[model samples]
Target: MRFRKTGAPISFIIPSGNLGNGVAALWTKKMGLPIQQVHFAHNANHAVVDYLNSGDYEPSDTISTLANAMDVGAPSNVERLKALYPDFSLLKRDVAATSVNDASIQNAIRKSEKHWGQIICPHTATAATVREQIGESTNEWVLVSTAHPAKFETIVEPLIGKPVEVPAPLKAILLNPSQSQNISPNLLELLDALSGPKV
Candidate 1:
């Protein structure tokens, strides 16, 4: 609706690992937006890179990375990806997906702070790096920065060499008394922890 007013073509460059936000953009495309394409930016763990480049969409174990939330090996929205573009060639044409490593992510953060004077999260940094790699384009790309910098202060602050002020709500929550229970990565351990009997 908004774009209809402006008369400009829209493109989305999203930091994707799970493909949820990408799917949302697809939905917008379904709604008849002039969606040029959607770019998926992954960090080190290039789980979906093969699917985009080739026609093979396989599931792999997600490796731990800076953008941990986007660490989905078997992206749940892949079916949507297939449904959107049943043909590999069409998928390749419409969707551009790539990977960025930890080093590149850090570099993006530093460069953005130095040049743009804005600090972005590791996940968002992935999109920034991909944007740079793609070079100049006539279309304006909207990068979907999934998380705020405040949420990833430890990761963002060190990379940018600056202090990120914690927001009021997060600060209050952090100031309050909170307890966390560490549990091994198993259902039994989780069950025991939830049951209040530490084994």
Candidate 2:
């Protein structure tokens, strides 16, 4: 989580799920950069469309794509992001947003496998689409690989036409004993846990 900028505009694209909120918070805390959280109405096709059409931010020609996890229609942490960076106008000037569709994602997977021989998960594919949109002349742009590709073995295997190998560390998660604790999605319930006595 080192926040090194290679003198290029940085944009963080997050999936619309529980994890997206945490990712935004971590980046805001770690990088101390203003984040533009893309919020999609549940029925909206593209989360970044309105933001782009407003003429507030210029869109990049190079957009990126990721698979299943990238299927986020509405991100939940946009207000947190704005609050973290009060100087919103300056922040909007440097950062832009876009999302890749399923078709584009599959094409990207085929293209990358053909060109680089590397298999990236759908989320990574989304980031790659953005990077490519930015063009080759841009500096080092980092894409967050949220999880291992092996997690989606069935889909990825068919795309690459081979079995994907699981990293040694991740293999442990598959082997080890684990437990799950279910919690209600209500904010008040979550707050009660935080306000409760230490475990």
Candidate 3:
């Protein structure tokens, strides 16, 4: 959409958990979009970065981080990426991967509020940190903001020293009652829960 609007090639720094969004960006580029590059931003669980550094794909146990949504170590979309770009060099060319630690994420959150006056969530901070490390580049970099800062107030508020105002839509949704089902870590339990009576 940015390409359609600006008619200029742009690059994206996506916050990825299971490589789903990053792979979709690659497909968008493959379909002849004017995307110059697609960069994957990950938290401590950086399986994609591991694969990019080494020509091997290995899934590890996920590490808990501020970016809880992006704490996926076994990214499901890696096979799709491999299918899209079979050659390792081609894959490397199409995608850039980086990992940000908890300290970096916190620092990025602070820097964002200080510089841009934007209180970004930890997931977005991952991409912001990568963008900061890259310095200024000719390519237009879009850091994908996955979630609102209000969703992570426990983490964001203390860092920014203020309350992140929840948007109207989010506030309305929050007013509605939330429902959840707790099940065991077994397949049958999940199946039973899924097939159980509707609330």
- Best candidate, lDDT: 3
lDDT of 2 by residue, 58-170 (tens): 22233232355544434444445445545756435444565556666566666778799988776566656656765764333445556677887776778888898999988
Residue 19 of candidate 2: its Cα lDDT?
36
**Candidates ranked by TM-score, best first?**
3, 1, 2
Candidate 1, pairs of clashing residues: none
TM-score of each: 0.83, 0.62, 0.87
**C-alpha-based local distance difference test score of model 2:** 0.53
Clashing pairs in 2: 62-133, 63-129, 63-130, 64-129, 64-130, 65-125, 65-126, 66-122, 66-126, 67-122
Q: Which stretches of candidate 3 lie over 4 Å from their true place?
A: 1-7, 180-199
lDDT of 3: 0.92
Please state the error at residue 191 of candidate 2 in Å: 15
Q: Compared with the true structure, what per-residue lDDT tens digits does model 3 show for residues 63-101?
A: 999999999989889899999999889888778999999
lDDT (C-alpha, whole model) for all candidates: 0.85, 0.53, 0.92
TM-score of candidate 2 against the unseen true structure: 0.62
| lDDT of model 1, residue 126 | 95
